[model samples]
Target chain A: MSVVELARPIEKARATPKGPRRRVTAWHRWLSPLALLVVWQIASATGLLPERLLAAPADIASTAVELTQAGTLPTAIGVSLQRVLIGFLVGGTAGIVLALVAGLSRAGENAVDPIMQALRALPFFGLIPLFILWFGIGEEPKILLVALAVSFPLYLNTFSGIRGVDGKLAEVATTLKLSRGQLIRHIVLPGALPQTLVGLRQALGVAWLALIVAEQVNATTGLGYMINDAREFLRTDVIVVGLLVYSALGLATDAIVRLLERRALAWRRGFLA
Target chain B: MATRLSGVARAFGDRVVLDSLDLVLGDGEFTALLGRSGSGKSTLLRALAGLDHEVTGTIDVTGSVAVAFQEPRLVPWKRLLANITLGLDAPVTKAKEALAEVGLAERADAWPLTLSGGEAQRASLARALVREPELLLLDEPFSALDALTRITVHQLVLELWARHRPAVLLVTHDVDEALLLADRVLVLDEGRIAHDVSITAGRPRHREDPELVALRTTLLAALGVSPEGRS
Candidate 1:
């Protein structure tokens, strides 16, 4: 009520300088990577590290530029990106559909969950030989491998997310007389989204890893194939460039998912943004 | 009567939660239920809300029913406004109006997790009353709030119930809260109504009023808490 009381809050606000501190923290994030790059450049310049074993950061950068100019990098990247996109679509949809069927009913869960769990325990990449035998060395096995890798995390997370919805909230639905469809659309799906996003982030990581492995095994194109071909020529710089491309793509996909999370979960004020 | 339950019996694994409960809640009447823990108060409320369906009962409610639980079960993922009108055909404008009615118009876009306990409970009340139900069941909706917030919510509920005129069944363990809010107070014991007292006290009745004090003493005795050591 008093002016002094109001002025005290303003005084406190003036005392706390938040903006500069936040900007400093943002800048600090890149400090470690830059340090690592500087170390690598120093080691290469001093000739302490042999060029044949590992490419210098500068050489990798210039080689990336060269590969881009030659169109090899861009074409390989485009192919790899398309494979991940399709694999994600196929795997993500199946995971959601199976999660819904299992999460909603005990009968569906009983019929589906154990088999999924059994399959989930088997390292999917180990089936590459079987896949090659069955589908032959083509895009089919590679895409399927990526899809298989992406599915399990999503299925598990989505299933748990739906199961973890508050029973009290569901009781609210009962009182509202929400139809079955309304219940799923409004309550179940949104409640499951937080966990589903966790699964999505994990699936994104696996999808990229799967694509790298699938392309490495029997591929004429993509970053994996480029890295493999450079290995024969002992072109460490080109291999490093290929690996960097994969890492950048992985980071990009994860960043996209993070953007989706922020948009979908704006209602949540999590401790970490 | 807006709600009726006859020969209603519910059990869980041979443990009887409600035994042959028979009651009728009058239209637009505010009724409070008081009981000890494990006295089947929640079982009865859940039955009325149709949340407990395994019960054998002839239950009839005149129209739609809404319930607000003790924990203010607003979905964490929805903003307060969306939580109020979730799964209902109501528009955002109606949700905003409901929030305003509960003195939370400024919190329409706020997340449920950001709300204080009292604010969340208010949002819960708004969520229920927005449905314009014929019956509104409250399961200790204010028990989690501090004393000051509880009194504010008591007044808010009174005002809302007065305007809406829904048949309200409030389940609480607070004797004073029951005496203050309800036109009729029912005490449950041993899976049935043990005391059904019609409160004759007028609106804005003082807690210190002899009639309320006497009724409070009676209700406390029914709850098996001795009233002998008080001032």
Candidate 2:
């Protein structure tokens, strides 16, 4: 509306102009996977692997279809996933509570920390025998094993999270006359959340791995069992099928955690990512 | 309520920081505690805040305390509103009101990372005020700021203290800052009170009054620095 104002140097006001758009989009994200599939197909067609010994993609695909038709794949995944959920919820909650107790009280830390540290250092997979012996080979042992595998990471992370909180923040908490519970709930928990979440995410992956390892010998209705049953007749196709299912499931779980992390660690986006 | 620190003694390893320190803070009085670097002024403030339990002394105060540290120490994960409300049992609405009081209403939902140092310190001040503390403690609350920001915060703290009427104990190494904000200045040297000078200047004190200039010159000399043109 005013020629003189329009003629003023807008460059000084804005300083930096927006740059050109990038050619990159997410359309090419699948290229590497597609290329890998092509390579697998080529290898199968070229007879690089023995047809019976190593199942071709087509054989594995047909096996997958058969398993799908028989409702075995869904059932197996259901059992595995159910076990994971129960174990993670129970284990994660207990770990956080214990961590808080130990972190807050010097006596509790003295009594519990060394034991927990030793337990955490022990090879979790090696404890399967003791768990079986103690709890029998029922679903109890399997579930408990998954829970045991998860507890250490969650507890350690939560403990460190509590310890790592800034002392100045605690001083402020005291200055305001915050009650013990109030201080832990508001200051300690949020301050240690990122580390705790990291622990929970790590524990989740460990739970899945532990569940699969648990399912190996006697499990009749999980992906591990499916693969074990396949190995009786040497059906590597079904083994590959099991491996694929497990990988996809793990990827989905990790993506869910990462989505939660984006919300949890939204503040750390620039620094962390 | 009055606060008294009687025969307060603190030592770190072999070095003595505060030796039988005796002081009384009158009701609603503003005192600036001055000392050299590593002079344990912060330790004294922390002891007053009930943070240093190992220190041997009877620190008697009739009401609750609130401390504003040199660093804002806001929770990085929490929003400005949440950080200010962290130690309270009150509802979120009350926290929002406190943030609004500090002119940070719009930044209520913004994370602490987005705040400037001055803004963060203001939020820290808001945090202290939210508790309505009877005694306020500050340790070099504006040391990290430029002159303008420092003066702004000094005025803000003075205004808040004037309105809230809490006994304030502020620790700083800056002589000019001591003159600008304090009712009385307690100078510490070699772990002892070297001087306790009263500022006779009236309320809303001018920064460069003759008395302030005289006191500033004296404090600088006590701090072992030549006036104005020291190399």
> In candidate 1, residue A11 scores what lDDT?
27
What's the residue-level lDDT of A215 in candidate 2?
92
RMSD of each: 5.9, 7.3
**Candidates' TM-scores?**
0.91, 0.88
Could you give candidate 1's per-residue lDDT for residues B161-213 as a string of tens digits?
99999999999999999999999999998788899999998988799989899
Model 2, residue A171: C-alpha shift (Å): 1.0
| Alpha carbon lDDT at A218, candidate 2 | 64
Q: What clash pairs does model 1 have? A: none
Per-residue CA lDDT of model 2 for A1-273, tens digit only, reads 233545435323333334332123234557898888878877878998676677778888998999889998999889888888888888888888789889888998998899898888899889888887898877887888888888888999999999999887787777777798988877888889888888978998898898889999568777888889989889898899899998899889888987887777777653333
State the C-alpha lDDT per candidate: 0.90, 0.83
Cα RMSD, model 2: 7.3
Per-residue lDDT of model 2, residues B21-73, tens digit only: 88889889999998889888888988898888878878898877888889887
Give stretches of model 2 more than 4 Å off.
A1-29, A267-273, B87-97, B203-208, B228-231
